[model samples]
Target: MSRTAIVAGQGALPGLVAEALDAPLVYALDGFAPAIPAQTFRLERLVPLLDAMADSDVSRVVFAGAVRRPRLEPEMFDPRTATLVPRFLGAMQSGDDGALRELISIFEEWGFEVAGVDAIRPDLVPGPGVLTGEPSAADRADAARAAEILAVTGPLDIGQGCVVAQGLCLALETLPGTEAMLDFAALHQGLRPDARGAKGVLYKAPKPAQDRRIDLPAIGPDTVAQAARAELAGIAWAAGGVLLLDRKATLAAAEDAGLFLWALE
Candidate 1:
């Protein structure tokens, strides 16, 4: 019947990707229908699922969602996974794009064409603008500084978002993510009382040469809400690479929150 498959990751992007490709999703979690009919399986059972798809005459596979970097833990390892562990680790030691390219090569060897979410859902890409409205000059200046700081941090594969206020880096997202970083900054009295209404700037960009298939930088309505709660002034993302999920809703939310969103060229 000429079947196709989608390996799920995280967020709404996976669902959108599956819909666009007209493929059945391979649900990685148990008993979750995932807004689409999918064959459920566990992560440890990936090899078997791949085998099943191959046996079913699946010709292509699309990867979507936010797959967090897997933590090294003994309990999560399986015999089949163990066989590929060394190679995976070697790729990690190399570079993010290198790792993704090598993994894509492996998939090609299995007789499946691998594509990214954007291949199916290009509309999700944000356009150049202050998606909400024009940022104040101060906010724009802060965003520029935040972008500079983020440029250095991104190559390390640390995190994408950063917060800047009055040219000072108020927070840099580590493992805790953007929301947590903002909460921490607020708690630490990072902003002065006089700077209460001052707008903080958030800068998000994909790591230099990031693997688009796996780690596409994403922002949506939740990001807008978080920035609003933190008294942030503006949000900036890489123009071509960043993914803006729920574009209209996200813009509406940002405008409602009095926050500015811009796609950097």
Candidate 2:
């Protein structure tokens, strides 16, 4: 009777993974999860959770959903967390890819095989195709331009998403995230509601040196809604490199909103 542990975070992805694996869900107390039986731990109280896993049949660990870095207080550090402070601080200072890899290393050091969410749901990675709406020639060019911008920004660990319109770079996502970038794009000079044709395209891809095991770019129903609200031509992402969460619902949203969802090569 093998058991797997899900380090849950925010959004529907964690719930999806839990359902897919029938795994024990664990999460930091600061985040949200479904109203189900799940073990909750504070950011610094990881040892107890690890010990509990060791005592159980759990052999693998998978992380799902998004987690913002928590601020740590020196007074709150337990003995185990105190010892891990250096590594934790290092990961915090590094790029997201490096941080996730460090986390994977930490879990592996505790004798559990770390699994990527893709292991449980391969179909989340859609192949190259236009999933909804129609992209005009200008839209296609914007997608290409956004991709080119991301190619240069990725290696710097800046961000995964960019928006382009009429051959102009509308916005680049930063620490504020993709949705905020879209909001900015929505109000940018080039994206007036009365503008002819489509406004722009949102292009997202993984960082050039990102570890495929975690922190892959993801788009869900909210993404489609935001793209639609941004009055964009479409949302474009690297096929097999982005997680299309709730594929049915996402496509439905895109179709209803008249927003194209393109899985680019």
Candidate 3:
């Protein structure tokens, strides 16, 4: 039997990937909120998990969902993990992307192929074009501005997504993630007369250097509702670089809310 291991994290994405990939080995990261239950382990148990995977004949690993970096204690490290402390610490200091890359490298070194979730579910990544409703010229312009902003910040390891209204960037997503940024945008809406018409966009794209396999930007039906509540005109996301969840429902919600959903190339 071919076996794949999902180092699951928070959100529904992990469970979705597991379902699409068939019932493979499911190991949830302990303390990480996952959509489904699975055998759990903390970050400090890396070596033991690797051993279990090897014993199970697992040949591939795909990481899914979001997780905050855990602070590992030296006492929790096994002999094998102890040897890796220096490298792990260095990666942590570098940034999230660097740390993920290091983790992927470690998984590879342990003889498992690292896979992208898109491999299991390709339809989730949509192509470039208008997905729902119609975007006004102003909304499109704001989308362009968002893309420009992402270009400058992507390499800096900042968060994805931004809110732009009336050609002015109202909020940039940070550690709090997209929803918080949307809330921030909604709170500050209509500061200018031109912005009072709910003419803005929630634009999202993967950082240029981001590893698509591990951390693709994603939006779902809830996002549409959030954007609607924010009184925004629409949402624009980089085509083939972001994940769309609850596809049919998300589109339907956007249509009902009179919100445009564009997949920007």
Candidate 4:
């Protein structure tokens, strides 16, 4: 019987996926410890890890949470991984989406189907509509600007999120991730060049060209709380392109903090 392997990363996502699976094989990276007990492995030992998985009858794989790029040491590479050095280097030059796609191809070549967390729990991906509060006209316009910013920047492999307030672009998610971006927005809420007093909207979506099968955008209760602290009116995300972890608590948090969570149509 083939078993599913959950390649765990850093965050609450892996645990959520595992809870819904039937006897899942959890392989977590060395540095990024998942909240669940998992078999630890390093990317440097890719071949050996695959061999172990094959021996364990693992046929399906799903990746969850954030993974830091490992430092590839040529001396640590096995004979097989050594041959792929050129491709790895090439992936590095092409940006995150390209690199992830290349990695997905590698998993496919090993005869394992790489799926997103949605495979285990589709409910986490909500349909279009607002989960709380109501957005005003200005909020909608800000959201449109944020959407345009993502559309323009997605091809550049910049980020999946941006903040726009009163027709002003406040922040764009960078290497630091969404939370950091929100913190940045919060810090400059009233100090930025513009003196507008209107609240903003935080918009998130998968990179237009990104392969959603691997890394999809995710938000939990913490995200809603952060957005509220940022003094934003609400958050808007692409429907079916983002994951809402712990849906119940997240929605409640949004309600408690008086922030809207809209899944754009």
Clashes per prediction? 2, 0, 0, 0
Model 1 over residues 108-152: C-alpha lDDT tens digits?
777887766777788887766766678888777877887788778
In model 1, pairs of residues that clash are: 10-65, 10-66
* Candidate 4 per-residue C-alpha lDDT over 1-265 given as tens digits, one digit per residue, 9 for 90 to 100: 9999999998899998998888999998888889999999876678788888889999999999888677777787888777778888899778678888998898888899998888788989999998888988888888988999999999998788999998888889987889999999998888544566568999999999899888898989989988999989899999999999988999899888888899998
TM-score (C-alpha, index-matched) for candidate 4: 0.95
At residue 35, candidate 2 shows an lDDT of 41
Each model's TM-score?
A: 0.83, 0.93, 0.94, 0.95
Please give the ranking of all candidate structures by lDDT, highest first, separated by commas.
4, 3, 2, 1
Candidate 2's residue-wise lDDT over 45-125, tens digit each? 767778778788788988888777777768877798678878988988977777788888887988999888888888888
lDDT of 1 at 49: 65
Point out where model 4 deviates above 4 Å. 191-196
Error of 2 at 195 (Å): 3.9
**Would you list the C-alpha lDDT of every candidate in the order shown?**
0.72, 0.82, 0.86, 0.88
Query: Worst ten-residue run, lDDT, model 2?
Result: 28-37
Per-residue lDDT for 136-160 in model 3, tens only? Answer: 8778888998899989988988788
Model with the higher TM-score, candidate 2 or 3: 3
